[model samples]
Target: MRKVFLFIVLVAISMASYSQKRYENNYVSVVVPNGWVVQNKGDNGLGTELMSFYNDEYDANIYNFGMIIGFNQFQKPEFLLETQMNLKSSNPLFEKATFGKMYNSSFMGKSVKATDFKTQIFDETFKGTAYAFNEGGCTVLAVGSYKVGTKSDLPQIWRTVKWKNIRKDTHVYDSFREEIEAYCAATNKTLKQTPIVSNGERYVSVYLEPDANIITNTYKFVDMEKSSFDENKIEQIKQNLRPILLNILKATAKNAEIAAREMKEGYIFKYTYIDKNDEFLFSVKLTPDDYQ
Candidate 1:
C-alpha cells in the first residue's frame, strides 16, 4: 500500500509539472495558469492566425481575463491602429470618446504602438490595453481586457510574453486548408473568411466561416491532440461538450442532430442543422487533429 501511495504521488507531481509549463509557438509564447485551457491556436478571420487563452474554472458566460494574439505581415502602425479600432467598433459599448491617445511602447524588447481603450458593455465598463508592433517581417498585436472592479491580470501575462521572429513563408493555416475548403463547399459558401485557432479552457474553436453568424457561421473543435486520442479523453469530451450542440442551436428553432463516426486517429463529431422546412441549412464537424 505504501508503494502504491508513492507511485500515485509521483504521477500527480508529473502532471502538475506538465500543466505549469509555458506554451510556445513559432511566433510567441506565454505562461498561462497551470491547467488553463487553450482554445484557438490557428487561423482566425482577421487574415491572420490568432491565439486566445482563458481559464476554464470561470463560468463561460461570465467575463474573465483572457488574451488574444494576432500575427500579420508588416502592417503600418496607422493601419494596425485602424484595425484595432475596427474591433472596438463592433462592441456597442465601446465609447470612441474614451479611446486614449496612441503612444509609443515596447513589448518583448520590440518597439510597439500602444493604446488604452474603454468599453462599456451591459452593466459594466471594461478597461483594456492593446499593443501593435513589427517583429521579423511580421506584425504582432496583443489585446487584453478586464471588467471594472477587477484588477487586470494581463500585465503579468504581457511581461512573461516572449516573441520569436517568424518567417514570411510560414503557412499558419495550410494544414487545415482541405478541411476548411470542404466545409465551405458543404455550406454552399465561398471560402472567404480566414479561420483562426483560439484556445479556451475546455475547447479550441477553429473558425471555418467566421463572418457567418446566427444562421451560417461554421466552426469546429475536438478534445484530442494530433499525436494521439484516448478513449477516456473522447468520453470526457462527449460528456462535457455534448450540450454545446443544443446550446448553440437554442436561439434557433431549427432542428439539429449530432452524428459520430470512428476514424483511425479519433472520432468525428458533426452537428447538422435543418431548417423548419426540413432543408439543410449548414453543418460543422469537430474532428481530431487529423483535420487540423
Candidate 2:
C-alpha cells in the first residue's frame, strides 16, 4: 500500500511538471506546451505583432521545435498568410524551401487555411505547418516548425487557443474598403461628366483593388484611336500626369486618416492606366519613399 501511494505521488508530480502554460494578449489566448520557452515577443514592423516559442532541447542548434503567433488588426487572414509566406520566401536562408498546397482546415476552433512546408538549412531539414484565421477584428497566424523526424506537440498546442470577444461585424478595414469603393465610384461618375484628359480621352472607370498591403487605383480610358497615341506618346502622357496623380494621392492621404496611416505603415500605392478594352498602358507604383 505504501508503494502504491508513492507511485501515485510520483505520477502526480510528473503530471504537474509537464503541465502547459497559457499566454494571452488582446487578440488571442494560447497554450505553450511544457519544455518550450518564449523566444521573442514584439511587433514585426509590417503591421503585425508576433510571439515566438521554442523547445530548448529540440531547438538546441537549429530551430527544431518552434512556433510563432502573429496578430494583425486590419489585415485579412489571406493577406496575413501571404505576407508571412512572402517574408519567409524572401529570406536568403530559405531560398531552397518548398511549400505544399494550402487547404482548408480547422484549428483552434476556427476554420483556417493551412499549408505544409519543408526547408533544409545546414545539416538539419525542418518541416513545418502554418495556418491563418480571422477572429473578431484580428487576423491570427500560427506557424510550427520541427525537425523532420521529431515528435512535436505543436498540434496539441494549437488546439488550446481560445479567441476572446468574438464578433460577427465587419472588420474596420473591410468597412474602409467599402467606403473607398464607393468613393471611387463617385469619382468615376464625376469624371464621366467631363473630359478626363484635354486630349479627348474619355474616362472609362476608376476602381480600387487591394492586394496585401498594396492599394491599386486602376483608371480606364477610351478614345485612344482619336488621340492616335503610340507607346512614346503614352510614355509622355504618363510623365506629364505623374505629378498630377501624385498630388491627388497626397491630398487624399492627407484628408483620410486611414489612408495616411496605411501609407505610413508601408502600404504601397499603385496607379494603373488601361484602355477600355483592358489593354495595359502603363503603371506607376509609389512606395513609402515616394509618399513619405
- lDDT, residue 275, candidate 2: 74
Candidate 2 lDDT over residue span 1-292, tens digit each: 3312321221111122144778765456778766665433433222334455555523344344444454444445555565446544322223456778778898767798888888775557888877888766556677777777777767776677677674433343356556556555655553443324423344455566654556676666755542466879888987888788777668656543446666767777787877767778888888788778
Deviation from native of the Cα of residue 238 in model 1, angstroms: 53
Residues 49-104, model 1: lDDT tens digits: 55555343333432443444545444655457654575443222243426788899
Local accuracy by lDDT, each model: 0.48, 0.58
Q: Which candidate achieves the best lDDT against the true structure?
A: 2
True lDDT of residue 112, candidate 1: 80
In candidate 1, how many clashes are counted?
15
Q: Pairing residues by index, what is the TM-score of model 1?
A: 0.47
